[model samples]
Target: MMWPFDRCRINENDLFKHDWRSRSKVQVPQYIFLKWTLAFLVGLLTGLIATFINLVIENIAGYKFLAVFHFIENERYLIGLAYFTGANLILTAFAAVLCVCFAPTAAGPGIPEIKAYLNGIDIPNMFGATTLIVKIFGSIGAVAAGLDLGKEGPLVHIGSCIAALVGQGGPDNYRIKWRCLCYFNNDRDRRDIITCGASSGVCAAFRAPVGGVLFSLEEVATWWRSALLWRTFFSTAVVVVVLRAFIEICNSGKCGLFGTGGLIMFDVSDVIVTYHATDIIPVIIIGILGGFLRSLYNYFLHKVLRLYSLINQKGRMHKLLLSLTVSLFTSVCQYCLPFLAKCQPFDPSTTEACPANGWSGNFKQFNCAKGYYNDLATLLLTSNDDAVRNIFSSNTPKEFQPVSLLIFFALYCILGLFTFSIAVPSGLFLPIILIGSAYGRLLGVFMGSYTNIDHGLYAVLGAASLMAGSMRMTVSLCIIFLELTNNLLLLPITMLVLLITKTVGDSFNPSVYEIILHLKGLPFLDANPEPWMRNLTVGELAESRITSVTLCGVEKVSLIVDVLKNHSQWVPYCR
Candidate 1:
């Protein structure tokens, strides 16, 4: 198949046509300065974007939870349910409208498109200015509405958008013309900058700068160089600086529960991981089960997204309707399902408060007795970020009942299935982690009699396993998980789980992003080639058509263009 807008290998003539270093107006030193400046700007803008999404989600979700809790506590169940569902509907509908009316490409987890771009395929409107705006606001609405979406994927898109704009000397429509930015207008320079942007994305999202660089190299970018490595590292360093500054600035509880946890989003450093060799039985089980479940998740997600695409192809209104319907369904499940959970009696002797009533806590007092905390309520009542923290919190093995976790995991599994690809900026990262964490907690609770290790460690490993199973990432995921949890002691098991799950998942099907790319029919190429590709030589494709052309001789531009037209773009030098 002919790849649209194909960028074939650069021949010697391209040096005179496009090389930045040889340009009369562009000095190498000045160009380097501009590149670094743009990298800093990309990181700064991406970090600010992440901060904006987090602050908005926390404030809106917190107030909604508090208001619903007040009504529920006062025995106004119908009013509470009405308010909850209405809030979700409105928020989700706003995001749906943004994606449907403003920019349809802003919908869904955008990692697949980003992967395509970094792999040298250019998809239209994938990183446009309008898409950036829609994704920024749409992500807020989707997550704040309590849908099973994450902001990391959209943030990555936003970073790439900013980088693309910078590569073009700002938005073309705005008509900002600067000679310094002209050096990056070429495809090669732009791709490199976008790679830095991709790394900055993960850096800001997880506060893991190193993982960001590794993620760009391992998962996204097909081309790599030592210079690009330094640029990507610099970009992520800037992101951490900006994110850290904001975290410090927002530490006084002014931003409505945004940066309370500091750089480590989930701080389990105090957990004291003490797993015996025999304790690895649970980790192995978790890896196998998490891999199976998440692979199944990818399969179902593909089917659901395909069905949504068909329904959405009819009109934009169908998109809005689907989102609203899912919002209502999620609201019902999140609100009513807690009643089925059996309350666990709170221990007064613990240092932390029982039935805590702040924005987030391990114990939730939802219509339970004064001395007891409802487990399901704790999982469903708070924001996803807080839910992750509470789940991964240390010494909380019995915090949630097995039945409560089972129901919670099952509810979200279905919720995530429908919530993705519904005309909103969604992501799979946190949603997968949440499901896996709960499943891990369930395993920990079930096997409590056999192991002495903290169940929180299992939850962490389970999260890594599910992520690896779905995404098929190795080193980068290992680092990101460690940075997110801040428990380096579990690195060995984390690596083991990731390797086992990734192998298990890959044995069945491609990664989720690959599935998305295949379904969308984007003509992208992966960095890793299959075994058959090794035996086939590039020259064989052009052998039949270019038999008369000389292999090494000067040729006119017209003759070269004519030869290119006859042969496929995938063909290398003709003989």
Candidate 2:
């Protein structure tokens, strides 16, 4: 799933230059020290960025929800809906304008660009200072607007930006430099540092350090080495430490919603879960469904993105209008859907159920009686993370009705497809998990008669299957789900589901990220050659292009000048 790499990274003459080799040897010790130092900085910055995004999202989105609920409670339904839709429009417009005006590269999942970069393509302004700024603030606005997307993927790109900025001596504009960091000026060293940064970003996003390392190895980085693996591990470890420290500091409730979940974003540790042999049958069904749905997800998302490309190419105004339209649609759905739910009376026998005030409760009282809660409101009104927690709660089987879940799944699928490919910073990871959990919970209810599996277990495996199917990853995704749930017992099932889902997805279209890469016109060279290429030869390909004049290692300077003057394009050298 990669394009052919044809660029020359190094000059063979450099290996023979005595001064270059001597200077490299002299800088070896400093290189070792500075790289680790860079790793620590990348991790620390990544954690801080993640924490920053979370805080912004919580306060802004929380207050928006609070305001909407306040208006609704006052019996001003029209005003409440207007305010909700208006708030979403304002927030999303701000994010979209940032991308359209300052850094268009900051839009979308950004994992494709990161993948392309790590594969050796030098994407212009990809990790630039402007892109970083736009990404940070833009992501805050879009996510806070309640779009069906996450910030995890954007965080990776942010971390890489920080790494590139720091490694490149803190931006040329600032004119900052360090003697020890000079070694990273080369493409190889900088790429490695960026790889570590990518891993640290994952660690910060999910609070899964080892999973971060595996993510970098499996998805982000194409060139892996022993030292890089160690550096990546160290970087992610530092991220975990930094995130833990932030969580501890925020435990006093200073940081808003982030203070709620410590490290695991979706913690099911308190829940007791166990599955039988027969449970495997339903789990397999979940995997098969996940793959089928994922194929549809990728296919439709690609077409939508293509359509968006046509609209976006029109102008910046068109991009802003598009964003506003989507935000309005989302706000309308979020506000109006809860009315369709049937509110049920609260059950006091089940461990102090429902809430008197604020969000995060399993039960949401939206235009309900004094003692009743609306099931669909709980899934709709609450934040996506909280919605996930409620669904993943093993204690809440009857908490959500089948109709409510089906509604959520269907609505989220539509919203998620539209939400992506917009001119704002967005992520697909958490939204995928959220939708997958909804699908899983629905499946659990469906298979209720045939099996006795806990709905929560089904939700976890469902998330794994969809994630694996869409991302086309197995080992890393399995570990990510394992770490997210903190339930080691679910590993075998998670692995099984991931393997099946990826295999099935491979039989269909490429993973979502690869499709996105293609959309961006980044041709990634696949390791496995296509069957139709069996007769294609290097000689025919070379003859199609302009002839290259290869020079010897000890070629004269005049000869090099002559070749440079003669050739219209690149002149390939010996590998």
Candidate 3:
């Protein structure tokens, strides 16, 4: 204070003191712009990677199935069956080995782990590079082996890993020159990035951007802020755009991946269900059935997973042997079922009159003489998505008889449940959707026999109801189905089914993902605690305490108001 510069230093210190109101307002815009830009880049990368993985899985699975089909066409039944069995065994074993030996965290649907991580739980190597690679390849192998799994679940994990890497500046070993992305390296920003990436993954998987945003909000994230909403929406939009462009480019060169137009596309032109006042009875029935099925599925699925865990604890070899045994059993069933069912050749008259369409010609031989799949081998061996599409098609009843549909429903329910928690990377969505479609079509056929209703409509309703019940999701699933079929007219019915399904499901148990989290021992806090907790008294609970505060008189009220005016964190509780 004795020196002249000391007074100037004190003034400078006072001027630079921490003050929220006096901070530069321009930096806020810059920070938001940079953060959003980083999110956009993360979404772009996630979409491109997801598209690549889907294409790869489709091609590999298609080639393997076609190889077996070719052998069957040449009358080499035993060889084809052997090849199919061997292919499934080898692929599943390889995928399992990769997951077990390299990245154990990559196995199963990774949504639970991701959910736990987003809730501030630290999981070792859960989002590492090894997991990303193993998940991508292992999921591809599992799907190619004709296992009842979908790539959608693993894609979320993959997207999170990518975002984590991008946020961390492209891994520790490599250097990333992008300085803008460094802004998101902090913990808070990285969580937002991961959320955006997860949303992007769903967008790529379902080709539904809005549905993706809703899914992340409803199913995945544990903590959400209002500011993150638009960021996730923007990310989903970017992902969808990138994915669509990639699909367009790929379609221009090839005939088209998966037919029916784009990836994950469904036909919705033949829906004829006009909801009447009396139809609520049947809709409610469907919802109840869906809920019961979901509960049953969860119970049995948990038991199977327990058995697998016990077997896994014995030794790694035991797990591999189990994989081989399951593969062999599945192969025998696939081989024998087709011949056991009634055989019908394609009608010569129809074949002669048909135009030379490449797309139709490819799947023409797969159809029987009655314009439907009569052989068991064809029905079981065909792609899951294709089977679901056929179930929802207008000609479903003509193509699949009532008895055959029932048989399929029974067989797939068992296979899908058992195949879900295998050692390899697997998913529940596609299999569950297929099962739900079969259930719906069977009911729809029976109803159409008496009433003037479309079986396709029933199929749609059944699918939505079952999925909603199993996943315990409502709005997102409805939007996803609407986007999948590009049909706005089905929204009301979809909403109704989903609402009923979720209500019934909640009455029984939590969702599949929540169950998995509990089994894994993750510290996930439930938003809605169990009803039994209300019985406990505060005095009986340990570490419970009460804080006392003194009340201010009327004369001190002005001082409190003044404090609230100056302090942003303080508010007038009375108001």
Best by TM-score: 2
Model 1, C-alpha of 224: deviation from truth (Å): 0.8
Number of clashes recorded per candidate: 0, 7, 4
- Cα shift from native, residue 532, model 3 (Å): 5.1
Stretches of candidate 3 off by over 4 Å are 1-30, 175-182, 255-261, 264-275, 344-378, 528-575
Writing each residue's lDDT as its tens digit, candidate 2 over 427-457 gives: 8998899889988889988886687778877
Which regions of candidate 1 deviate over 4 angstroms? 1-3, 6-11, 14-26, 257-259, 262-265, 533-573
Clashes of 1: 0
Question: Looking at model 3, how many pairs of residues clash?
Answer: 4
lDDT for model 3 comes to 0.72
Residue-wise C-alpha lDDT for candidate 3, range 1-575, written one tens digit per residue: 11011010122334345542464777557768877887888789888877776676666656777777677667787888888888888888888898878988898888898887777677778777888889988987887677766777887788788878777777566847675555454456777788888888788778888998899999988668899899899988898888778767776766233444446434455555566666667777778888888878877877787787788778778767776666667667755566656644443443222211122121223323434334344457756655566577653345566776677778878787777766777778877887888888777776664544467778888888888888899989999888877768778878888998889888888888887887777777566778988788655653544343333545487776666466543212332
Predictions in order: lDDT:
0.82, 0.82, 0.72
Query: Which scores better on TM-score, 1 or 2?
Result: 2
Worst 10 residues of 2 by lDDT: 1-10
Better of 2 and 3 by TM-score: 2
